[model samples]
Target: MRDPYIFSRMHRIPGYLDPGDALILRALLGHQNASGYRGGAAEIGIYYGRSFFLIERQLRTDERALAIDLFDAGDQKSGRKRLESFTERARDMGCVLSEGQVIRADSRTLAPEDIIARIGRVRMFSIDGGHGLAHVRADADLAAATLSPEGVIVFDDFCNPEWPEVTAAILDFLRANWDRLRPFAVSQKKLYIAHTGIGAEYGAALDRAEGLRRLPRAPVNLFGHTALRVSHRLWQRIGYEILCRMGLGRMSAMLY
Candidate 1:
């Protein structure tokens, strides 16, 4: 049976995550389930709760979804509305709002200790905060520090020309923290990173996912570990354009 939370209802949430990228998220989370990996989830950026909600769906009832964003403090009323909308949607989706903590703060200002104290070690953390190099580096550093063993971190807008700084920051982070984290997979808009010990497992899982077969995979050495990189920009664009035509124009415009 199709999982309503991850597959059906999640697609209805308004956000910039393209269907392809969402599929990647589902596959990674699903793999975690199949492998019995246990830990909470988190996102450094929660705009209208699009990707955040999907991450929430993958959580066990006891798991928390820690979301950090500037919210009304940065985006003003729109950010407030997005948070309100996310709250209502979480309720509708049968998620406990209390378990999903939404913190309004600049991600760059958040220290690793602050996150660890608040949310503990997360298995899956999404970094989609400010696209600037400094901001991305800070978020990445925090994620590396707080991620659990076998946990995966998703970096948003990697290799996207529109946000060149994100790519640069990610590369720098990987280069500096090679022993701590490694890139296992790269979708069109997002890159998946994990601890060196388990990065290969995620890469292998993504390689075997049926939905991601068409996305070309190449084996590469990341931080001395065998990792897989999926570079399929053409397929990503095609799928994203189809989603735009299917009524996600605004979201697609923002993402693409």
Candidate 2:
């Protein structure tokens, strides 16, 4: 299957998505599309539209995307710069976003109804907004409320040392909504989850996808549910870095 975005082109945008994560997300979206799932995509905390646009590119013509972020909020210099760069870079890259698709606000204040009102039910919802436990919990709530029956949620920075709360928040949310949601897969930087009814289906499909290489380790047990850990091999990661340094990022991304 073709990638949602050229690696080199995505690399030019500023954000924390790696090729392996991109590959996993792309594969899941492919599975959804193949299964005839129909819905839009949404993300919290869009840092210059890196991952957001990646998912948007894969969306069908009738589908749409929504993004929420505190661009230029609190008078932070970094936020202002990111807002300006996000606009200019998107324009230069020729990515067309519709009105009200990107919102400049703290996600904590937004309701699921607001999100659904803007983009309808979502097939893929990304939570990379605030790292605090409350923030993550709130974002997860929004995702759950707006998700389609077979929708998936991608949580960033899961189990990262820098943001221990992200892991805690996700675990807490998962346990509370155990009957409704089940984790299906996990990458180094993100976690993939879906409704319990279809979690196993999604996991099994991903386990068979050539784009993802399941790790040798045993499955992760999260509150009686299982999540497969998948990522590129060490050699592929090294090769990707080397090729990018050699100005062959687009070709190197094929490894993912």
Candidate 3:
């Protein structure tokens, strides 16, 4: 399938997310749509609105997105600026600022109650804030408490060498909440998780997609459940870039 959204707009929103990851997001959201799931989307760390906008694009008209971040503070000055830029860009893309919320706060301090009060259970929540172990633990806890039964939680930077603490914290959380959640897929930049009972369905859905199954996969003991780690190799990454420029990034899944 050709993804006009990513090819024509995704790159314009600056962030660390790869195009392949965006494809996975699309697939996951598509599954939710097919299953008739309805809930808000959320992101703990929205640098500008790159991934946030991508998530927003998938939301139904009634669904909203919640963006939590430390905007306009200390080293996040650039982030604050980008956030403003994203607002304008989003407007240009036909999104209303009022459709979602942009909260400027340290996510570690936000209680689960605070989140639920603002936006009920979220169908898709991304934890990408503060790479510290403590921060990751707190974010994970909040995400868990506010996740919908059929929802998915995405942990960013898992296994990334630059943020080794994130991996440790995530594994710890998984071990502690194994009965509550289980990982189904791990991409180059994120790990996809869901309620344990629902994880198998997601895993099967992803595995059945010819595009997704083509990615490199490895067996992983995610806390306790067996899972697949799907990621791009060096050559695949280069090929993805080329395909994206060719406006065929969505089809790059076959390259694997």
- lDDT for each residue of candidate 3 in 88-130, tens digit (9 for 90 to 100): 7778778776733877889988887777776788999999989
TM-scores of all candidate predictions against the true structure? 0.82, 0.90, 0.87
Ranking 1 against 2 by lDDT, winner: 2
Residue-level lDDT of model 1, residues 35-132, one tens digit each, is: 98888788988877888887888777777888898766333545556567767777887777664377888987877777777667889999998999
lDDT of 2 by residue, 49-117 (tens): 889878887789889889789886332545467767776777776667777788889999998888888
Overall lDDT per candidate, in order of appearance = 0.77, 0.83, 0.80
Return whichever of 2 and 3 wins on TM-score. 2
Show model 2 residue runs off by greater than 4 Å: 2-4, 73-80, 213-218
Candidate 1: give the clashing pairs. none
C-alpha RMSD for every candidate: 4.4, 2.7, 3.1
Which residue pairs show backbone clashes in model 2?
none
Give per-candidate clash totals: 0, 0, 0
**TM-score leader:** 2
